[model samples]
Target: MKDELLIKFLLKETNAREDSEVTEWLAAGAANQRYFSQMELIWNVSKQLAVTSTVDEDAAWNKFKENAGQLDVQRPRVRMFPGKFLKAAAALLLALGAWSAYILLRPGYTTIESAATVRTEILPDGSEITLNKNASLSYQTRFSGNRRNIKLNKGEVFFKVAPDRKKPFVIASGNTTVTVVGTSFNVKYRNDQTEVIVETGIVKVRNGDNEVLLHAGERALAGKGINLAAQKNPDQLYQFYRSRVFIAHNTPLSRIVEVLNENYDARIRVADPEKAALEITTTLNDENLDHILEILALTLKLTVVKEGDEIILK
Candidate 1:
């Protein structure tokens, strides 16, 4: 069979007559079937490599020849075909070599960044991660070997990890490391500090020599001059990016304003220090900045004033 016809058949682009011809050719002998299988593998691998990086065909051929020489002693005997078939087989071996080289030379981590809005990623092991705005995360493209490891380069990220006790899901955020078998949690790395909040299942946060295990509804803070310890999660504000709702359960005005500024890019502050301590329990759905501010003002019975570029409440 011609290489073009075989390639078209491999790609499923062949017409009915061509398909019949290729099917009949494969049925003729095991060697023909093996040749077609080799071509199919080469086509798939080359297509994948084409998207990622440029392939050096000459180098790949050379690598394939070198490896083929080593395997010749153990290689199975097959009837030889025309020079064109040999050339096609060489191309197949070349692609296989290129794929191997690509895997070996590729960077260890595939980094992902969120610019102005939240981003979601599903990992190879079925773990899901939601990155907050300006957040960065990195992980191996293929989860090989034992562990499923990830790095929270900066900003906040929530993880809903798939269960795999044998291969634990681990994340590195700044100096802290979080380890879990199957769990959902949030990790925020900002201002040289790493904070972890567990929403479901159990999470282990480690900083330097100190480590703390946190359960659902618990959190931990790790940074310079900070003791690593699990504490009760204050509010559901951490999930605002994912849920699109700012939930305050008797949350302080100061804390609420801080999150609002982070989420909406709004400069909101409590003018009176006493008012900053005032607590409010409310769920603010994602809406316009002005509308959210209006709700906050009404709930706190405070006046909202626009002074320069800042919004102040008293």
Candidate 2:
């Protein structure tokens, strides 16, 4: 145990195990026992000092000042700068100010807003972003000198980032940060969880020191305190929101409906929880909602009932 921890044990502040550990350490050798005895003596002396408050603060300060003055202390003298040096300093300061202003107002940002509709936008670096409804992507116009950085303000976005080995692309959403040199990935910010699904290339997702690398068909979750966990992506249903095509390979019904609800304005609710686990392998490409629902109802032996805005599957 450390001296500080042993001090805590000496004060009866530590638990039984800590006390025993300190006791065993003290009993190991004469040096250890001597160290503990000295510390104990100091502790007892400190307790006496705490009880007796007879020391004069101002008198001690004055005594120290007198003693300090008796000892010779060297002090450095300040030198004056020449006229030419002052002029150069002024010019340097002015140049620095101009540079600061240029950096502050650097080319501004290009913001693409996809409000209630899926939209695609090409970034300045030739990277493509397919944004979901209510999602917005904003990045600097000039990515030449600066990092290829983008911010997902709300909702989800699929990024097909162009390869820039020197300048890595970084996407920041809430506390989560996804960095890549060149990659295609889906980043979704939902219910305080930032999910990263990599379609191609490699992505490094970090929330502080808790970071995880994700490759193609791999997914990761980044959050506070390094809850870095990655696994094989369960499905690629997130792409449906941007592609208008839902491809399922032995996917569960519950998982399909979850993606469907996010893609369409209307909500798709599975009435029976037990049937959600049923595996389905199908491709939905530009199919009408009514037709797709009809097919799903027939295949799964479930009834599809529409009540107002919500579609209920029983």
Evaluated with TM-score, which candidate comes out highest? 1
Provide TM-scores for the models: 0.66, 0.65
User: What do the candidate models score in CA lDDT, each in turn?
Assistant: 0.78, 0.72
lDDT of 2 by residue, 198-266 (tens): 999999998866778898999987766546888999886888877678789899999878877776666
In candidate 1, what are the lDDT values of residues 1-314, reduced to their tens digit?
66567766665667899889999999998766765676576656555445444344445456664543311122212332333333454455565554563343332567999999899999889999999999999996656446777888899999999999988888987788999999999999999899899999999988999988999999999998999998999889999989998788889999989998988888888889999999988876777788878988888899999999999898
Off by over 4 Å in 2: 1-107, 144-146, 224-226
Give Cα distance to truth, residue 114, candidate 2, Å: 0.8
lDDT of 2: 0.72
